[model samples]
Target chain A: MRGRLRRGLLLLVLVGYAAIVVLAAWRHEIRPGWLDAPGAVARGLLAWAGIPPGVAVFTADSASAAEAKIVDLCLEVRVVEADGRVVRLHPDAGERCPAPQPRIWVKGEEIWLDRSAVSLRAAVAARRQELRRGQSARATRLLAEALAAHFRARAHAEGLAPERYALLWAESRVDTNTGERSERDVALMRWGPVGEGDLRVSWRPDASLLESHWPALETP
Target chain B: MSDGSSSYTGQGVLERWLLGPVSLQVMVLNRIVLGGVLFLHAASRAFELPRLYGEAGATWSPAYRAWVDAVLAPDLAAPLLALVAALAELSPEMREVVVIGLYTVLLGSSLAFASGLFTRGAGVVAVVLHMLFVTIHPFAHYGWASLVSPLVLYVVLSRAGDHLSIDAWRRRRRGLAPLPAEAPAWPMRLLQIHIAAMYFHTGFARIDDPLWLEGQALFEALARTLFTRFTFELHVWSPLLVLLTWAVFLLEPLAAIFLWVPRLRTLCALALIAMHVVLEILTNVGWWNFIMIAGLLAFLPPPWVARALPGPVPASR
Candidate 1:
């Protein structure tokens, strides 16, 4: 009789538990709004536990603009200024900025951005396809380098002396799932006086960035 | 003690079907493995506490906040929101230090639970800490964590420290006889149902997607080399990829049901384990595959565990 009682109670609890799991799955797949009640209960528990609530939401079009938002990652940037004023420039409307994401590292002079989201083949294919179709004449280019060049061209169009401002290469990516903006410095190149300069760009390896960020990454 | 009905007749057929004798060893083994998984899970995230949870961390997602505000009562959301707001006042260095400190506490609690030292208290604290950590960041939490959260809750309700643990060893040293090796059937039953339900829901969910139906889901997933162990340039193998995709889709619901059958249970368990292993190798799902593998271990009968250990099995009380 006792054994039967134990089994009965265990069965009861297990069924109750299973009901909750199945109901949750159903809610998640079918009636997601139903979860709000439980979520509210949980939040109340968390509130009772003394966790603060607030969302981290911000926008960044340039590396300097992302400085205050750099949380757990280290970003290195060399901003170029003319006459103590930042050569502020924005991307053309609807174009993704070339600013790097929050996670980046500096190796000597070159900054390597973590491009985990983009494949080299895809980037190369997009670039080739754009050029092949003569779509480069369009207002937008999907290639990062091409987008950076457009921004640099914009800076020149603003009448800033080329030699007076260092070229800031912002590596930016909007997270596809969340639409969150993350931008940082990829590479910065110094130029000579306007109309008398040869372009030389520095390239860094993906693994090299790991070495620079390892120390800070140890705790974060 | 009777609630006005005989124990046999009062319980419905469904109740009798659900309740049965299960090997205690299965529950104990699950407790140990699940605890270890939880420890490792917490440890891995400890390294990213600041970016995941602190003020200086990634943007506090608006979507995450809105969901919390809308679903949660204001009283509950207020304190949580207040805590998040308070982080802004801390200096960056101080914030990092505090985040590190919190992660350390979580890790230590997890370790204690895994080792079965003060199992109930430590396990309870660990579960609470884990739930809090889950709430801290939208990105930091994942499906595997959510799945394990309930098991951890069950762990606290269990006499999981009765065997294969520091608590058990100490009890033996103090002249107490060890608990009978066989555990009540409910824990394993709960786990079995949980796994089946997961597969059932997910399997059904995938069938509705055109990608799975058309057989391009696995192939498209494999094309992204980031998650896979290797890349194949085999354009000719599209048919095989589709077959593999259908196999997964069919196997899930089948396994969920057949896992309860005596004749088919072992086969289903083995196949499910293989699926998880193949998925693990083919994808970069982190601890998810490991968690599933551990959960699957409950399918092993208690006799297997008892035969391997040195102690003679105590007669069922």
Candidate 2:
């Protein structure tokens, strides 16, 4: 082929590639989005006409509405406990808590905040009994705001970039039988051992081989 | 970038790079460049003090290590034992001599691979040692992390030393052949395929992640070194940079396709090269990516490289 024609052909292929990405983006998709389809195309092309390389990678999308709902629930809890008596219970907070030792994603140090950490839970329930507890209502609003910020901050610090992380966090539904010591499934970067009492940490949730080693907790 | 044929009025830049249809010499350079990459990589494993003890210890692992050794026993043993020839071969010799002697054999094996001298022997030795080391630390890293051995091991088997090595020198003295006169092309193409797999799989695995989707992947990557690059310790996000991130994100697989397409092969070569250049500036991917990107030039027509070779060896020679 002539040099000019080859260049033009090259231009056409590049333009075609850019056009496909643009179209995919417009159609609510992008590279690694419609991964299966192009993979199929590439695979078929290769199988029938021989591919240079045989390996390929795959991907999928996940939802975040469930997480947002949970965050909303936490906010509700904050509202339910506002203006209650000072539960000045334990400033000992986490000083006596066991050291967190997650089994996975150990890039740096990590700590966990349990549901029981809410030293004010039962106290608020008692004060919330009165019909016109005006001061307690305001306390509820403050609690809601703090909890919301805590979850968001946790998500961000875990190296989760907003959207997917928030959704996945909510996906990890926190559950308990008698509420004695309920656990929250937390996957984050840490630098040490995660004991049985500490938070659960698993990075590649999809890889069963790995996840099984550091099994993530979940509620049915 | 459009300078493919845009008139070189003075210095002859085009003549130096676009060597018209792929040539035999281009193929040799392709193999040599590939050799440099293989040698450098193997050199690390060979030189690493920590890995030596670690892999040597694994040879005694009661678990799967023994099984792997049983299968490739001979291939897995000789050079590895040679690596441990650390025992003073000559007691009369100085400790520095021992160090230098071990290093000489190690370096010679690497150079043999790099220069394609007795490459099959060198390459085999390289793989055997690599297998032994990795088998021990299979927990420390994954097989994907050591992806190059199988690819260059292909070169060693193809008798790459026949053209570009001291082995080739020995061959020349024996009066067998003038190195076939035409370069074999499939091995390079095979290599290009291998690298494309690495990039595609890497990108594919991270596709669903929010950072890659929002184009913050590159930003986070830049952020690792962001605190130092600027005078002000700044964190500014630009819409334009994000758009560029998306552009490159979509380009890797596209470049792979272009490299395969014969008509646009040169264009693809340049695009991929530029991609690596940008990657080099933005990340610390090491010579792995850069060398692979440069080596992708093989897909271009030989004439492209034909135009690229020097007019003469230069009278200084």
User: Which candidate should be chosen as best, given TM-score against the real structure?
Assistant: 1
Model 2 lDDT per residue over B33-125, tens place: 655654565466555543333323322233223222222222222333323333322242353455445444655665667676777787676
Clashes of each: 25, 29
Stretches of candidate 1 off by over 4 Å are A1-14, A27-29, A32-35, A41-52, A56-220, B1-21, B45-94, B234-237, B305-317
- Give all candidate RMSDs, comma-separated: 13.2, 17.8
The DockQ scores of all candidates, in the order shown, are: 0.13, 0.03
Candidates' C-alpha lDDT: 0.54, 0.40
By lDDT, who's the top model here? 1
For each candidate in turn, the TM-score is 0.61, 0.46
Model 1 TM: 0.61
**Model 1 CA lDDT for position B24:** 53
Q: Candidate 2: TM of chain A?
A: 0.24
